[model samples]
Target: MPTFTTRKNKIVLTDYNYRRDIENRLFMAELSILEVDVLQEIINGSLKTTLTTLADNLEIAPSKLRPILDKLAKSGLFQIQGDGVLVDKEMRKYYEAHIIKFDDDFRPDMEYLQGLLSKAPIHALPSWYAIPRSSDNIFNSIIEKFLFTPKIYERYLQDLVFDNPIISSIAKQVFAAPDYKISASALIEKFGLTREQFEEYMLFLEFSLVCCLRYVKTNDVWEEVVTPFHEWHEFLLFVQNTHPVAIQDVTPITAVYEKEFGFLNELNAFVKKLLKKGVSFTNAPKDLLEVALLLEIAKQEKQKIVASVYTEDWLKKTRADQAIILYRQSLNRLIANEQFTSFSEKDLREVEKSLKNFAHGKWVYFEDYIKGCLAAVGSVLPTSLVNRGKRWKYSTPNYNEDEREFIKLITCEYLMQAGMVATGYHQDKLCLCLTPFGRLSLG
Candidate 1:
């Protein structure tokens, strides 16, 4: 038994069994260092730290620290406030005056054994195909020791297929077939897998196929015929084109993009074929828009890019030029109005100067140079435009809600394409950055 002196001068023999049980429970559950530290601090009544402070103490970024705190909060061990963290009173009291003991002869309880069996499947599946049977046998023996159902064995097999990269690849290849029916026996024979393994693989593939089918159905493309054999050949061609001589060296952006947008290599090759047939961009705004949409979609889907910023800049410049032309036309209409005749010479001169400024292929100072420019452009400006020029030294765009969102999406996609960042679209709302692995794959 363990005890501690309270603030009331009372010797409290905190329940040793309860403390041991709780400690064991925590040990059994997967906990990160940050989580353990947070729980311990709270138990000791010394939790006087913010997320930022904890991050600094742990030598981790604040972004990474937040997720750990979120997990602790989710587990009901800690209550997270905008100011700080608070531990559950009952849990804190248990840890305050009792210590956990792990004796050599101590074995886990039946409930713990049941939990262990549940986690066994994830442990048994290795990254590689070759499973250490001795380890498998140990896990299988644990299942048998507890007299768990045959479903446990089935789960282990399912995990084995789920974890196997080769099997997953094969399943993806098979999924493209118009009316594909892959025999389990054929898979076993082809992959040198046992019958039990083959059945498990089939089960996993069935689940995956169902998911893919659901997506296809929802998109109203279920009836569309996909030639698996042709797609497979195309994939092989793509793989050949993208293959690197040295695995240590980085992969090209083109290769990464090609992998994400499947059959894109074939599509590009087909486009080149059309180019040989004299296809041109001269009468192709619709086509250009389609390509832009595809690029946007690819960015949303974590695709890579092969083009430079100069190319996109040129395109944007063309669009901006079109917008400028529209602006000039609107300015012309406003200037031609009979209402302008009553203006003073200085105002009229300012108006003329603004028009002259705009005519010279300049956009920045058009408002100061031409009164028409101010009338035409400013007429459309929203009332909510915040004028920050007086308060701040730098000139900022008075971007409305729509313009701000557009800028954010465009900037995110541009940064991703420029290799400065990795981003994916979140429907129509936001863009999420790629993971380190995703970024590395693009390199």
Candidate 2:
């Protein structure tokens, strides 16, 4: 229940109370830039407005906008009233604040994305996943608890996958295929699904990580592929008290998610601790593992953070608590950038400048390369591979410039090759700890 307030004509969100996993799910589902923009509009526009008026503001057909609007409304940001829609005053305020902070137009114009999504298939990445979606499901750790064991797929089968007979039949048909592909004709039989349900199932699977349209040329269209990213199986090992594998051992999948999404691990581990207590459903029990991940982050950096503050619900995080997270994320970057080089105010300013010039998702090349560097260094962000020294056709839109490549090589590959981050064993896993140089960079 984050509270919203207006500040300088923008809404501010406080007390981010919703579960992080929920937000993670939404982001991973590739919430189009347009949808986020629509949220911005609701917050900044008149509280009471008709669908047509909103549509007109975005220059889209009201008919085309309705479904998107309706879906977002389910998030409790708004409600469909008699003739028009009315938004929750507070959530509207919250969104306004969020948009103002980013100060970037990440508007997902749906018309462009829908077309682009079809064209984009998962390509061979730089031996690591760029970033996995929905950190909660990364290892399927918490999600697995909700699902039954022995047959992992069986858990979600009844509750989600086959809950709708149509999707159930679709699942069965698709699973029967020798490969992840199933002909479209196979799913269209007998179900009589409304166009809406079909679309819903498709979207759900994308989020669920059950499957996605990776595009098969012989099929000649984007077709659902089963169980996104098979290498994610390595993450399942975390459930056991097994030998520690170095962070580098995890990959083909990007390391960013393991670090970025580590926040949720605390919550998920806490829930399991409660479940073990066998407490009544209504009674919320103590969470033993809460804050464990943050503490781990602190320990790795030779830093310390208040346990209670970082563990508090995101909505309840103090400004200081929030700053700690941001500072740590930045610290990791600074360490990687200069390899233990001390950063002056000017140095920090340059980092900020780069971030401002290349907002998240804008500089895909730099972002990916940086992520690769963080993964290589084993920073707050995680990498999938443990060994360095191999280059693949690391595919991304060409942002090629001689300087950029040199920087990427120096920042990511050379850091490890030169031993800027000390590497060794920790609990049977690969450990990449910050070196003396890295420690100095924090100052």
Candidate 3:
């Protein structure tokens, strides 16, 4: 939720509540830009308006608008009476009480959209792999999570691969020409779109991170320039280049983008191989272990850096240029020595033995995987207080959750991100397995 206010005849959403991940995921998925605009128009109107009136306000033809209205109605967004639509009682009450205004348009400011999705810049790295492997799946599970079968344009350039002819044409034109630029008016005329439709569509495309639009005010007329991604690497490069301004209160780390892209190329091949075999990870790890280890090193070396506070010093120096240089040296030394840097030889052997016990290319519960790993090290689970049933709970003081978290930190958080493991769901339970890369690396 965000605090809604009217400033100079424009609606501004400020003070965004970040603890709305589940709600944000659903809201982004369930409501399209056009749907939100339609709902906004209805709420601003009498809350009961004819399709013709609503369509006219939204600048959409009644025939083209009918399906959107019907879909919203089915979802209990509003009620339909023949040609008229009425806002649902509960939904209207909530909107009026908390969000909507009678006079101002409910269109959210683009700044708020960018701020709300600041994490997008971070996701661009993994997306370098995802857009090529399966652009439809949410990238790295770090971007907007599109659970199950996601809709087109749910996240990360999906709209480029949209089934709609107009979008397909747009994608082809953009990709066919590097740094394609088109004026708003010209694009609208070329695509035969109303002004409102063009705004909604472009806004959706921008939100999907497919392109970036820079608008200028000239002689009281706003003109927009669309710069679409010309290559796969351009997406991350754009994010990296613009993150300083786009993401507030966060310093953009100078990552080795060329090196990262090289790794992504390898990861993309592995994912494509899996997809070709009709196997894709439903869940993949987030966070980079190298970054984590470097951060730890930075913290240990923070005495030399000057800052007002410990957090400030830590954040400033963790991914700083000097730190990156130091980390590279440290990493190379470890690699040259062939040392087990992160774990003991015993622990690594135990994990390998545990993984070897299970057959690959099959789904098993994540808990089962954790239990097998713990068992390989001769760990025992206490019996339950009550008699065992079809689904029995372990006794208190059991190390299941603790061990699961630690193991996932190594396997899911680190190994999976390294393309050594892939996780998915089987019967609604999280599961994991070794990838072809993982088997070869281990062997």
Candidate 4:
């Protein structure tokens, strides 16, 4: 029978043998590190520990440690009682009833026994642990070395690490096209990953490439850097030679690239421009607004707009002015729509007056005109109705003018609801426009 000597100098049947002697067997063959530690403590009569104590000892959060204990209990290794865990009474009785003996010099060889313990297959381990720790610490050492000595890494791994081909292909296509840029958020939407997972995968891929293939980090986000095809080819050859198993199963790498390339390609161009312009120049809100307006203009022109005019002088002279133009253009498009033609002359005049007021900085009157027009179009309810103004003297209650105006601009949903304006959708938001009665009054 297999046996283990406890730290207290008592010989006991191993969990496997004790379980077998009691005519019970584990359904699964492996336990996590925490489980192994907890089992050893239980056997040694030192199992009294709270969740916090376990977390402190294990260097993990109490919430994280609790799940590990729950898993052990669920797997029939122990019975959790109140705040403590106990050995399975039957298994313990079996151990006591059929005690095993070993040589006087027989000491528990933890390292050897742990090695003997059948662990989950490499593929079955969590990706965080499995991908880094497998193949006799190959990936782990590489990641450590790359993070610590980035300069040495650049010299050694640059030729071997390849640029992500998927992103490069997409970027080439985007750059080749006129007046178009990919949307980073749209690409993320396609993959449906949480922000954290996307970030983790990006970091993992970048570090892996840098250490194994000798890539350099040239951009704030590593994904934004341009990698040459020749470098990538050499990197693939290196991967094939150094880690045959990883090369054999390239599905993980491929999946990550396929999922993220659409967004990364667009972001790469944006980052390149931002870096060239310098941080102080690009950080201004006006500069950003100008970029947005230029992008919009480029969309209209069907041409790409380079950041050549992103200078301080350009921002001081033209950024805000261009934004105003774009805003005016947006309003003009709304007024020209077929639905607005049915508006009465008085209502059209009100809209024009509001547009002029907005141009001259009478922000409050401009807001009212925009809201009244939206109400006339049935896109949003009048601020009064949604705000329950009937009970109060003022049409807009509690909300300041700025707050009401902000809501109207953001939730204008003409493209939503099949291009029709609807009020119920926006709920209590001053987002709803006028009913038919209100529209007829404008006429």
For each candidate, give its TM-score against the true structure.
0.18, 0.22, 0.23, 0.17
What lDDT tens digits, residue by residue, belong to model 1 across residues 1-443? 00111212111113122234334334323444445555554555544557666666667787876777777675455677875776677655544422111212222222223332333244333211133545655433443421233233224333433345645555544443334423433445667876445444433332221111110121322111112222222333333343222212222222223233222233334333332342333333342223433433111122322332233333344322422332233233334445433333333233222222223221121112211122112213311212243221111124344433323322233222333233332222222233232234223
Across 318-388, the per-residue lDDT of candidate 2 in tens digits comes to 43344355344444544555543533334333332232212222112334333322121211212232212
Candidate lDDT values, in order? 0.34, 0.39, 0.43, 0.32
**Any idea what lDDT model 3 has?**
0.43
Best by TM-score: 3
Question: For residue 360, what is the lDDT in candidate 4?
Answer: 24
Best lDDT goes to which candidate? 3
Q: How far off is residue 119 in model 1, in Å?
A: 27
**In every candidate, how many clashes are there?**
4, 17, 0, 15
lDDT order, best first, reads 3, 2, 1, 4
- Candidate 2 error regions (>4 Å): 1-21, 24-29, 100-443
Q: How close is candidate 1 to the true structure, as a TM-score?
A: 0.18
Global CA lDDT of candidate 2, please? Answer: 0.39
Worst 10 residues of 1 by lDDT: 209-218
